[model samples]
Target: MQYKSQAVAKPYFIAAIGLFVGQILFGLILGAQYVLGDFLFPAIPFNVARMVHTNLLIVWLLFGFMGGAYFMIPEEAETELFSPKLALLMFWIFLVAGAATIVGYLAVPYATLAELTGNDLLETMGREFLEQPLPTKIGIVVVALVFLFNITMTVLKGKKTAIATVLLIGLWGLAVFFLFSFYNPVNVVLDKFFWWWTVHLWVEGVWELILGSFLAFVLIKTTGVDREVIEKWLYVIVTLTLITGLIGMGHHYFWIGTPEYWQWWGSIFSALEPIPFFAMTVFAFNMVNRRRREHPNRAAVLWALGVGVMAFLGAGVWGFLHTLAPVNYYTHGSQITAAHGHMSFYGAYAMLVMMMISYAMPILNGKAANSNKSQVVEMWAFWLMTIAMVFITLFLTAAGILQVWLQRVSDSPLPFMVVQEKIAIFYWAREISGVFFLIGLILYITSFFIGGDKKETA
Candidate 1:
């Protein structure tokens, strides 16, 4: 709303929320498939549903990040976007390509889709998160480059702030690290090694920078905190994140045929990964407590605090539970890992994006904040989703603990399938949580249409 060009973010946010709905729907499907393996066996097997579920997560978050950047950059830079038209064009291109990729996943077998999309030339298709075919991968790179170019130019041409600078570093790092996905090695160990460069580094590393910057921006606006004070917190966070995140890559090296020394190094560094998140929690609360003015977007402020606490618990505390070399050795790929992944992602990235949306959407629509009724509804969505995710994580953690006990630690180990049957109850609990999450999402979208008497600003 500060600059005309910021309007471009509207479509991006809309698309992100739309795809988010799709992601949750697919997630419910995957959850059902967990209990009933043949729920959609031939038509939409577990693997495909999972692929769609995760791919939708990555894509929608990207959309949210891009939209947040487009909205924030102009105000931070004190100027208009460098090229709104180009930004809009890239948005459409990215959206179409993403949609087509999902359609491909649903329309044909994985092998056929890979072949049809030139996966033979560069075989990045079979990787866990980088399952996009060559064309889609290429499209992502192009869109990212153009998107970065637009924002970077705008920053260079205008004023630079700590938030914007850190955001640029995070964005640039995101693109740089993604290149590792293309470097698939023939050796399984080496492949896993480089794959973590993309996977682990992303969620734990640069993405945190992005998270920090976005949180700082919201805190500054909502709390009326001094930029200098927030920037100090940002500096400490960036330092801790880099120090802990970079060497923390060793954590994944423990069983991957790496040096024996990594056992000590990975444990030490990865254990410290929680420090930055802890600091982020303190920073969010401290700012709100010291607020200069009460912003009308109380819901946005709630989200800001939620991201802090949830990110700390999900990414920090739960992560620390199994992050050490000793614990991970026993629970390497158990449901515990899945628990960490689900909570950490939702807390850190998903909620951060929603926070940005909650704050910016009202301003974008020419108001300072939505009516109190609308905000109350939004807050309900927040609690429902956050609480539901917590239950999901807890149930998975329980399942993982029981699994590790019965399968790995026991004298007579049970088969994987047998163990899965035992854990069916936990999966059932998680599916019920998923239904609540979907309802929360529905309420979130519904909030937009609910209007009332409110102050209007231009």
Candidate 2:
């Protein structure tokens, strides 16, 4: 089956690039606001910056997933995408909708956006059905469904390989599960309960499947590791991820006034959640070490290896530090949680996606590999961003621990505002470290436009 589609990878690549830039800018804004307090308002408020930060992370990761799918599906299925034109169309529509939604978030206050989108209307009336989280939730559902349909149909028509098929099914599950959050029950407890259906399930659940498959795809292509070896690791990683993560959702319910049983359930399962990430780290490095062929794209290899190590530190180590109910009793909603979230997402997911893009760029552009010079620059960017983020996480973790001790554990607990004042230095340090991250992003964006040397020359 000869599969030919105009490289669908390019658009998704561009989208990923745009979102990466947006994320860095938003991160800087968020960091500055933390230190400067009254910085970049009206033009870019703190809340707005935060919204952009979170939303851009999700969007760009999705873009990476989509692009990776486009690149991998044809090879795995042994056939072209079912509808290349439809895939292209969905790309544009999603981009436009995502941009409009971001604008809506910035242009109007949260309350106003809710009202403008009829979320408050439904809430005010007896219906209570359309609340603030509803319209945005609906938009996400639509986008997820569209993406699922495109990917599923393509897979259905093509050859079925373990890696590609797992990703396809995983993404389909991700889309379907996200829709459950829209019809949140009337009970506040239940609303919070179901909210994790989308948030926890996607990130910690099916998205792990997506990430595992993506990592395996890249490793297999770049390292020329035995297919059997790589696929086995992928299977083991996903199996462990699912076993621990599904039950780990109970962690969120710990302080939400849910049943007491969740104390044990959440803590135990969440504590065990790091095992798979540890396994992933081993998998990536072992494959690279056992590679049968050498690739000139050392930057991509470095990023892949970094993803593993960082995932261990960010997701495994830092996450377990607070997963226990005893520790979380004080650290909930503190900067410690923020620290873990930032590094884990960037290290495990974002780095993996970036590695995929870097690996795919050569294949998509019909080049054997990127130039040593550009690869070196990108590798530097990776190290810079990775190191800066590590510093940010550590500082925030310290600050969070301080806040928790001062507010929750002190002899005479300080007021929250007073605690903020106490931690002001840490915030300043975080902002300064974020400057390094921004610099790394600038280097990364610049590398894309400035073409790399040919593989033969390199």
Which residue pairs of candidate 1 clash? none
The lDDT leader among the candidates is 1
Residue 245 in model 2: shift from native, Å? 0.3
- Model 1: number of backbone collisions: 0
Candidate 1 displacement at residue 27 in angstroms: 0.9
Residue-pair clashes per prediction, in order, are 0, 1
lDDT of 2 by residue, 342-434 (tens): 899988889988888888777666766766667777888898899999999999999999999999988999999899989999999998899
In terms of TM-score, how similar is model 2 to the real structure? 0.94
For all predicted structures, in order, the TM-scores are 0.98, 0.94
**Per-model lDDT:** 0.94, 0.81
> Tens digits of per-residue lDDT for model 1 on 1-458?
78999999988999999999999999999999999989977999889999999999999999999999999999999999999999999999999999999999999999999889888888887999899999999999999999999999999999999999999999999999999989999999999999999998899999999999999999999999999999999999999999999998898999989889998999999899999999999999999999999999999999999999999999998899998998899999999999999999999999999999999999898888998888989999999999999999999999999999999999999999999999999999999999999999999888887775433321
